[model samples]
Target: MNNWIIITPEGITKSPNDTFYENFQVLGFVTATTKEAALVKLKENYSYINGSGFDEVWIYQLRFSNPNITYLGIEQEEDEFEDDFEREMVHKITCILEENCYTDITYDYFEEDSYFFEAYSDAFQEVRVDVKDETIEVYDRYIAEKHFVHFGDIKL
Candidate 1:
């Protein structure tokens, strides 16, 4: 049974966009004092990607002039202390990412368990649909934790 997670605009076909055709570490505005501050922040740091074939994702932050902290890029992979061969691979991926950076201070990382920052892209096509037609899931991690804490008296 493959667990599925779907994130789409309100009325999408309810398909999971989880499989990445391509991904990049991108950043956009979060909350800036002034519009100028937002622009400056976006100018210094942000995230984006071009192309396809992505399996995992991560999110992180970046620094810019006005000392503004902007959300940047979505990435995959894990570790950081990369070997030479890995470094070369990351460079290739970074090239693609940088080429697609419509924002400032963009970089890429193609390593194991990559660092991803939320608020990466500003492009989303929302899809809205009636929930009754889909098999939706309601999960609560807290409930699971409580179950283990008091395993004897389980309640449905």
Candidate 2:
């Protein structure tokens, strides 16, 4: 059996205007033959996932070869590595924001974009940075607001 990491948002969806921050929680690790089987095992064993209120969840296969690496068994608390995860995620976001001249960070997640940070220069603007893709998009807040209201669209 292979180990897998299960991740999901902390709670239900929030208002579009609410400040967005990364709050992904690692549900825990499960042993299964495949990713699909791992998810099935998690759903069957963990009641939290059934009522998690999240639209989706992600799973990553855990693979390591370092003989010196310590292994925290599956019985370890779920939050054991949460602080490190949060620090890394926040650092990446902060770097992206700083590199693009965005300060006083107020970030939020759009259903479409997953997560975005907002900052103002002369006028209100919404900045969406896709760290995985190494891409950034900036939009006028007014335009974003209008699009969000009329079309439920935030990506451009």
Tens-digit per-residue lDDT, 1-156, candidate 1? 111111212121222455444324222333455444544444344322112222233222333323334555657455563587555544443343334431232333332333221111222111111112222111111210222111121111
Q: What residue pairs are clashing in model 2?
A: 20-107, 20-108
What does the lDDT read for residue 7 in candidate 1?
A: 20
Q: Please, what is the whole-model Cα lDDT of each candidate in the order they appear?
A: 0.29, 0.55
Q: Cα-based RMSD of the predictions, in order?
A: 21.9, 19.6
In candidate 2, which residue ranges exceed 4 Å CA deviation?
9-20, 65-156
Worst 10-residue lDDT window, candidate 1: 124-133
For model 2, how does the per-residue alpha-carbon lDDT over 1-156 read when each residue is reduced to its tens digit? 886877776544344568656677666567789999998998776655576576578898877311122434647444422356444554566565556555556545434433455554332456554433444344334222334211122122
Task: Give the residue spans of candidate 1 off by over 4 A.
Answer: 1-80, 102-156
Scored by lDDT, model 2 comes in at 0.55
